[model samples]
Each structure stands twice: as structure tokens, then as C-alpha cells.
Target: MMHHLLFCILLFPLSQLVCAREEAFAIVIPSSRLQCYFVPVESANHSKLIFDYQVIYGGISESEENFGLAASESYSSLTVAAETLRERLIRLRKQLDASEHFQSSRRVYETRDRMLMESKLSRVNFWSFINLVAMITVAGLQIYMVKSLFEDHSRVGQLLRRTF
Candidate 1:
């Protein structure tokens, strides 16, 4: 019984470690200014845009015959990257399907719950418009105040210098 209990305890952590390693994902974002590459994590499900990706590493530029400037840019590299990511995600999905902890039924339940909540939330009114207007007004007032204060201080400094 003692040996059996020890074996179970050892296997539990090993299983967890293996599971964690199986679901691991790595994304490298290279920047010229920053020497080191960064792995960005998804913060929210609603937000699909990746932030701080200013550098364009791999892409083809199309030249315009009539005009001097480039007409368009090809997204072949980006599309290839997206396809690779999708393939990885699909593999992960298949692994998760086989997992005892993560089953299709649970996913369906969660999806239904999320859809229901979103539907209810969509019916409610938001104060976003009012907030946006208030924010713009405050920013405009702040800029005007700063500009006026700077002008007044410079004029006062000029007068004082002239008097001295």
C-alpha cells in the first residue's frame, strides 16, 4: 500500500507536467529597436488585434509601372504565418478533445452561456457616447489651459526682463 501510494503521487505531477507541455505555444515578435524578441499573450477573447508589431520582416512589395511609388504589398508571409498558427490551434483542439478535463460537452455549455450573456448585454444601453464626449471636452480644455498659461507666463517673463 505504501509503494502504491508513492507511485500515484509521483505519476500525478508527471502527468500534469506532460499535459502542460503539450499545450504550450510560442510566438516570437522581433523588433529592430528592441534586441530581444517578445511573446505576446492573448489578454481578451474579444480583441483580435496584436499590439506593438510595427516592424515588417517578410513580405513582397509590388511596383507600379505608371507611378514611382509601390502600388501594393503582398501578404504571403503573413498568410503563411496565420496558416501555421491555425494548424497548431487545430492540433491543440484535437488534443483537448481527447483530454478528460476538457471535453466537447463542456465547451458547448460554455459557448451557450457566453452567447446568452452577450445577447442580454446587447439589450442594455451604454454610456460610451457620453463618456467619449466628456473625454474630448476635458482634453480640449486641458490643451487650451496649458497654451494660455504658457503664453501668459512668457509675456510676464518678457515684461519683467524689460523692466529690470
Candidate 2:
């Protein structure tokens, strides 16, 4: 009897369960200043345009508020005093270019100095120094031999010195 009651209780819940289909509804307001539409509740793409406009054109509202009261000619003069993001970027780019030029010139000079030092080091090695000293010593001995030969008055004496 207990098992039959348990079966009946489980079957009663399964019998009461029902399946339903999804339905959607919409409300349209055909006004420009107060426009509203159905957008996905989880997405923010609908508001991206406003954010982009705010980033690209930041000073529009300020200009309208301050310059709207003045004449059109004066508005241009006022705008000239205020630096926009574009002008700042241009100025920064020029500075960066100048810095790059300076760095390039410095690199060229450093490379030249390094090459000159390397060339000097290669030419003045231990073997070259030794050869230079040996050449000097041999030249001095040749000059001394020529002076002694010229001082000897007779060819016989020069021949004797050469033989010895």
C-alpha cells in the first residue's frame, strides 16, 4: 500500500506539469525627441553612437553655450584660443619627429666613433709594433755602415772591412 501511494504521488506531479510557448509584445512611440524601441536587454550597442559622438566632438556643448550669445565672427576668435585634441596631437607629433631626428644624428656620430676606435685598435696590434721597432733598428745600422765606408779612404780598406 505504501509503494502504491508513492507511485500515485509521483504520477500526480507529472500529470500537472504543462509546456508553454514564448510570446513577445512591443510598444512604439513615433517621436524623435523621445524615441524608444525594443532592444536586447543584455546589449549596449544602441547607445554606442552617443558615446562616440561625445568622444570625437567634446567641446560642442561648451561652444554652443558660450559662443551662442556672441557674434559669429567672435566665435572663431574664441575657438582659436582653445586648443583641441587634434591640435595637441599635431604638436606632439612634431616634437616626437624632432626627437627622432636628434636620436638618429646621435647614433650616426656614435657609430663613427666606434668604427674609428676599432680601426685604430686593429692597426696597432702587438705584431705591428714589433715590426716597426725592428725596421727602425735595421735602418739605423745601414746608416752607420754607410758612414764607416765613406770614412775609409782606400778601396782596399773598404774591401777588407767588407770581407771581415
Best by TM-score: 2
Indicate the residue-level lDDT of 63 in model 2. Answer: 32
Task: Give a tens-digit lDDT track for model 1, residues 1-164.
Answer: 56434433332222111122244333343322222334454555433423222222432223322434343433675678899999999999888768846676788899999999987776543566667889999999788655655575666555655676
| C-alpha positional error of residue 104 in candidate 1 after TM-score superposition, expressed in Å | 20
Query: Quick one: best lDDT, which candidate?
Result: 2
Position 154, candidate 1: lDDT: 66
Model 1: residues with Cα > 4 Å off, grouped in runs:
1-125, 153-164
Lowest lDDT sum, 10 consecutive residues, model 1, at 12-21
Residues 117-137 of candidate 2: C-alpha lDDT, one tens digit per residue? 998888789679999999999
Per-residue error for 100 in candidate 1, Å, reads 26
